[model samples]
Target chain A: MKTIESRSNPLYKQLFKWQSSAGRRDEPILLEGVHLCEAFLALGRQPQYALFDQTRITEPHLAGLIENLSEEVCCLLPAGLLANLSNVDTGQGVLFVVRPAVATLPTHLNANMLWLDRVQDPGNVGTLLRTAAAAGITRVLASTGTASLWSPKVLRSGQGVHFGMHLHEHIDLLAVARTLVVPLIVTTLSEANDLFEVELPVQAAWVFGHEGQGVSQSLIDLAALRIRIDHAQAVDSLNVTAAAAICLFEQRRQHR
Target chain B: MKTIESRSNPLYKQLFKWQSSAGRRDEPILLEGVHLCEAFLALGRQPQYALFDQTRITEPHLAGLIENLSEEVCCLLPAGLLANLSNVDTGQGVLFVVRPAVATLPTHLNANMLWLDRVQDPGNVGTLLRTAAAAGITRVLASTGTASLWSPKVLRSGQGVHFGMHLHEHIDLLAVARTLVVPLIVTTLSEANDLFEVELPVQAAWVFGHEGQGVSQSLIDLAALRIRIDHAQAVDSLNVTAAAAICLFEQRRQHR
Candidate 1:
């Protein structure tokens, strides 16, 4: 194993850029911890590079992982240097730089697509992606205000589901809604129609909005149906991530 | 405005302890950011104390919040001191110390209670609480392995739902389930009954498990019904938070 100790080392600088950059402009996204690295390997996707501290090389599971990697794909850095590259305070001592998947909007429409409008929280965005994948959704359209799908926080929250779906970022949500032939259902707290009472479309696009605001007026007006999950008197709204899961699951249940 | 500059100040130490000690011992939960603090006030609960960065006291919305606070409840800290007390890297420039509500198990619960088994993630635990409240579920019993309900992370995830419910953390789930007169419905991946097909009980306790391990054997054996949310081919399981919302909503739909 080769170890680079200097924080100013070119490799360390690249790792820093990978963690902090908004988009994959010049650097690949960084996947930290062994769980994600194993997920990458299981998918047969070669990471651009793997960096680990020398101490981690002694652990059985990590050592096995390192031995399984192709020589060209592995690199070692000092513990302090690796820590500096981690977004979380406590780094598990392994980080992988992987090329972000080339995501696009689906050309052929399916009845089930998730539209996220200005959903700002990274954890919420990531949880939505996981829910979408669980409900067998294949494509997601994220508007300008939505969190970057490839950011480290979002990637970690998604837990490798990012590699499973088609994710198009910074899209014109209203334009995409207008182009779709399938029924577009938007979730809203103001809607009088309860989700369970409304007949879900066989093939439809589901749109979810920001945490505080429901779907934007432009998108809400474009919707074929406005649905709400009936709630008790105490709560104002469900957490956005929780709402996404419920909406997607309801649609899947109806289609079944 | 009152300014406290010393990091060694007792107020600073207490805030730091509340922020860092999620796993160790029980303490008053810390609520960060202005939005949550505002929500707390709207609910008619007074904070033990509030710390604000002196510079941020000038921002209009924040200034309004400060104005609303009773004079004795507000304490202004130096910008740098406020930065040190904050858990999030970009602090919303306000923090509140509030006593977490003490939650109790319902002795004569007639269904409509939630039993969580070893849900390790604080965010999931919090989201479950919020969903539980929205579904009109007043009682939640968390097994010993479940994340602490009063943890700063869970409290933040619950988004103030803790105050609205009867929450019992660190309990023997199987023993409690055995004592209940209502049917125990446990959610599992291997269940024969699809959640939508089952006649959901209006007054039954719904039990959910960890993300990785389905409900434990003891709890499984205690359950009168085991149910699953059917998904399309290739998808395995839904995230626990999403699963909780769907299950809760389904039960609510059946009763309504």
Candidate 2:
């Protein structure tokens, strides 16, 4: 195993940038925890290098897993230093640095998709990604005000589903409207047809908006339809992620 | 405005206990932020007292709202001191201490309900409550291990919907199961009938478990039915709140 000590190790600086704001540099993404490392490899993606805390690999299971990684891609660091690489408490002791997967918009699209408009919370953004992937609606377009998709907080909450989808961030809603061949349906709580009452198009693009605001005005105006899921009348509306799931699952339900 | 200065003041101590953990005292439940205060009043509930930060309540709208809160219940504290009661970086500078509303279980119940089995994270617990209320689920029973239903974190995430639903926490699942007349359905990702393929009972009790563990074994065994929501095969499962929304809405969908 190769050792890298000191935060000034150019390598550590690079890792920090990649972990916090990989989108800024178009560089390798830093994935922490054994689960994510396994997910990355499971997707048949190779990492630039895998780091492990030599002192923390005492558990037979962890040791065996670390030993399996080829020496060429293995780098060892002190346990405390490695822990600093993770946001999680009692760190997972392993990390993988991989190139961000390229996301291409399908030239001829028919499948349902998800569009996020200015959704700021990283956990909500990431959880939406996981929900999108799980619902098999993989193509996601996020607007400029949305949280950066490649940030570590999003990745951790996303649980490695990044490899499963085509995510395009910093997208213009007008550009999407011009290119999309299917109905652009926006989910809102007010002045919309009940989701159950409306006939969902077999293939459409669904838009969910910011926590505080409904879909941005421009996008809502361009929407072919607006649908609202009926809940208890007293409460204002559903949480963004909850609304996303209900909408995505409704789409799935219709197709199924 | 009546003043409260010293942290050692007995009134401040009582307020702190109510804000952080009041379930033990069977006393007043605290509400924070201007939105929650408005909701509580809109529901026709009166708080024992409303507290505001002298310095932070500058916005005309906020000031007017606070002024309308009735002089009998108005209490003022210094800005920094009031901010200490909040978890957010910038406090909203308003809090209401309302007696916990008595929630009575329905006799000979026919409406669908949701149950929380030791779901511990305050955010998840709160979000679940919000989801349940929005989905027209009025009755919720939570296990003893679940986070206190009225904790500030849960209250904030609930976004004022806590008042719309009947939340009974620190409960014994076994006792509820014995008393429930509706079919109890436990959600699990493991072996079970696919949610899409199965016939969902329009009026039933749905159990969502802790984050790491799915539905507990005893609850699973006691359940009248076990259902699994189908997601993309690669991912483990959806977030519990997302899962709850899907399940509850599916029930609503079927009956609607």
Q: Pick the candidate with the highest DockQ.
A: 2
Those runs of model 2 whose alpha carbons end farther than 4 Å from true positions after fitting are A20-25, A106-109, B6-9, B17-29, B56-58, B102-111
Q: Write the per-residue lDDT of candidate 2 for residues A1-256, one digit (tens) a residue.
A: 7788988888887787676665553677788788778778777666888988887777665675565677788888888778777777977788888877778777766778889999998888988998988898878889899998878888888888888788887888777687788999998766799888787898788898999987988888888999998887868888999998998888788778
Give the per-residue lDDT digits (tens) of candidate 1, residues B45-153. Answer: 8888888888888898688788778878888888887777666788888888787677556677785788899999898898899898888988888888899887768
Let me know the DockQ for model 1. 0.63
Q: After superposition, how far is residue B64 of candidate 2 from its true place, in Å?
A: 4.3
Computed on alpha carbons, the lDDT of every model, listed in order, comes to 0.81, 0.82
Candidate 2 chain B: worst 10 consecutive residues by lDDT?
A: B17-26
Q: Report the C-alpha lDDT of model 2 over B229-255, residue by residue, as the tens digit.
A: 888775888988889888888888887
Model number with the top lDDT: 2
Interface RMSD of each: 1.6, 1.1
Candidate 1 residue runs with Cα over 4 Å from true position: A1-13, A22-26, A52-60, A63-69, A76-81, A89-93, A106-111, B1-98, B103-106, B232-236
